[model samples]
Target: MSQALAHNIIAEADYLATEERASVRHELVGGEMHAMAGASERHNRIAGNIFFHLRAATRSKTCRAFMADMKLRLGQGALFYYPDAMLVCDPTDDHPHYKQAPCFIAEVLSPATAKIDVREKWSSYQTLPGLRYYLLVDAERLWAKCYSTNATGQWFEQELSAEDRLEIDCGDAHITLTLNDIYEDTGLLL
Candidate 1:
């Protein structure tokens, strides 16, 4: 969604190595390093709100929620990205630098990233194993797009508007959140 570092293809090893030393965050997709643009205040706040809700929902379980700083690796693709927020219930997903077993991922869309997020990233995330849900949040409006898979692993999408509550059913752990939960203090509603 952000700008690619260059037209050149960067090896996975180099991308990971360079990201550690770089000040800003970057994503590696199709062997290309794309420098992530800074999130707007609304974007950060919305992500924070989701993290808070998810963290609290999974507090009693083995699950944990992480915000933007944590990197996520796309299994088998050698692509890595920073989701706005993610929820992981697998204790075995304890990687030193990145996670691979996130059951849920949320991306708060900015004008610059919306197209890529909806098309490219959406296609990629759908192929992940055991990924229960993917959420796309609107930074400038009261809307959220939900892509969720069923028990049979078929994907379906839903759109929530205004104060709609999204129900996330991950069997043992369930989370229900409304627009007010994410847009509360972000001032995006105004």
Candidate 2:
């Protein structure tokens, strides 16, 4: 969530309509619209790296990967968020403007959104029945955290450094990502 546009509550339909024509992006949360801030170069690079890997990994499979421009609808449209990167495998979740269910989601943390991403989004995302993996990547450092659900529906956390490789199982396909792949061309590895 970003900064609230105003104290007034906006209807979901109205927010969607306004967002369609609005120059800037806004997320609807608890009936209030919050204006999203622009990302830094480093943030964009990190997010792009994640998206690139996810897209390639899911290309031959039924899954599709999306970047920040795609909105993820939650809480029956009461909460809408734009994740840095996400993977959706369910064919029924084909909304033109937003996604209702995602199997995997990644958020690259920045100074402004780190707290909300770690606390608010983390809490909300876990409530989704189809969500199996949630990744939090640090933009300023070579660190990542992954929360994955097991067969028993219990969630476990794993912390990764530059040398670690992350393996994700996406039903029919499995994808592996390394810090070198994520931080490539960002000058972070240098």
Candidate 3:
């Protein structure tokens, strides 16, 4: 789902201010605009499953779990990214676009966008000051990998497998996950 930026129909700033609530979502990258692709049934299911677990796990905490449709306004240095799922622990979750610093974010990868998720998207998400964990899920393989920021602020990767139950430690709240749970009904190749 990659497309060349159509001739600059609107300036990045103007695009931001206008149609902020438009039905068709567009992402800004170095001023180039690319419309988002519609989700497939598998895509929707994976996102739904993750959010469901996150919501229940964080109910008593200050963190809020959200589905992919929520816009994330990554600040100046990066573009606005709409992750497949996100968790925000910052008290500023009231902001429009869910611009508040999020503690965790996940992207369900499709073959068309896997590189972007593993590279560009991963790089952009890491820039968020308050971010702690980043997870990448492979739709075709049903594989999951996570990156957690260490005490010195550097991020480290952790790989999760079907045999092992995974838990994301988020201070007061922890999100327990198993790869099999997300792909239960997907009938994924792997």
Q: Count the backbone clashes (under 3 Å) in each candidate.
A: 0, 0, 0
Off by over 4 Å in 2: 1-6
Query: What's the ranking of the predictions by lDDT, best on top?
Result: 2, 1, 3
Write one digit per residue (lDDT tens) for candidate 1, span 1-190. Answer: 7975657778777887898899989999988888899988889899999999998898778887889988888855378989999888888989867888889999999999999889988888887797899999999888888998888988898898775779986636789988888788987652
User: Which is better, 2 or 3, measured by lDDT?
Assistant: 2
- Return the TM-score for each candidate structure: 0.90, 0.94, 0.86
Give Cα distance to truth, residue 88, candidate 3, Å: 0.2
RMSD of each: 4.1, 3.8, 4.1
Range of the 10 consecutive residues with the lowest summed lDDT in candidate 1: 163-172
Candidate maximizing TM-score:
2
Candidate 3 collision pairs: none
Give the Cα error of residue 29 in candidate 3, in Å. Answer: 1.2
Error of 1 at 111 (Å): 0.6
Weakest 10 consecutive residues of candidate 2 by summed lDDT: 181-190
Ranking by TM-score: 2, 1, 3
Give a tens-digit lDDT track for model 2, residues 33-120.
9999999899999999999999888877888899999999999888999999999999899999999889999999999999999999
